[model samples]
Target: MYRKYFKRLIDIILSGMGLIVLSWLFLILIIAIKVTSPGPILFKQKRIGKDRQNFQIYKFRSMRIDTPDVPTHLLENPDQWITSIGKILRKSSLDELPQLINIFKGDMSIIGPRPALWSQNNLADERDKYGANTILPGLTGLAQISGRDELSILTKSKLDGKYVENITFLGDFKLFFGTFVSVLSADGVAEGANKKNSNEKK
Candidate 1:
């Protein structure tokens, strides 16, 4: 009942409420990005979503215009591509604010598996094995709270599959609350002790 009907209902209500509440921040990020970077304020990239559907995920542009469209965890020198403002935005995770629009549009949920970029292959095999494409991707999930950039795709996929097996209204609530704390602490910025290349294994 919840998955089929109530989940979407909750998504709509919460996403609408979030947009209304965060309107000022959204405007501020837009202006800040424009002032700091000479390019689009929003970054859009193809990501794998439910059933392997491709959608352009939106985020506040946190890198310089010249930065490659590379995943943060894979960057050889992640700091090199970040603008001065981008560093703070990325650290504070304020850059993810644009995903509220994704939630509003039904491209993402507030809670679920964090969507993976199409170029990522570290966990592609496991993602397929876990059947993670069966459901909508999310802005945050168990894997995100558990490790964010620190966890490999295989680890994340495992957590994602676990969430899919036991999704519930209460579970989402817990994951959402946990994500807030994780973001505040800026946890999962790097995986393990590696501090880099969490997206690809050696």
Candidate 2:
């Protein structure tokens, strides 16, 4: 019942509120990216969502316009493509603020497995085997708190599956609160794990 009904209601309310509350930051970053980068202020990339559906995920443009389409870890030199403002946006996680729109559109929840880029075939394949898309993807999740950019795709998908098995209003609330602390502490990067090549290429 929680998964089918009230969860959608909660997603609508919280995501709606978040969009309104974060509007100012959104506007500011939109302008900042325009001033700092040569590309569009917003970056839209196809991501795998619930039921293996494809949706375009929104994010602030943080890399150079001509940045190659490569896995972040495989970028020969990621730092080189990041604009000055992009660095700050990434560090503060403001780059993800745009995903609230994704929430409003029902492509994502406030909490679930971070959506996998469509290009991340290996991760998506693993998720398919585990039925990870039975639940909507999220801006953050158990794997995110456990190890954002640090954990392997397999490990992340496992955590995501765990969340799907036992989702609740209370659990989501707790994840929301924990996410605040995690982001504030700049815990996006995994600790004691290799930041690069976290996803093994299949």
lDDT of 1 at 6: 90
Residue-level lDDT tens digits of model 1 in 82-144: 777777887788878888889889998888887777776555557777877788888888998
Top candidate, metric lDDT = 2
lDDT of 2 at 168: 90
The residue pairs that clash in candidate 2, if any, are none
Evaluate residue 28 in candidate 2 and report its C-alpha lDDT on the 0 to 100 scale. 86
Q: What tens digits encode model 2's per-residue C-alpha lDDT throughout 13-118? A: 9889988988888888888888876778888888888888899888888888887776566765677877899889877878888888899889999889888877
The global Cα lDDT (0 to 1) of model 1 is: 0.78
TM-score of each: 0.91, 0.91
TM-score of 1: 0.91
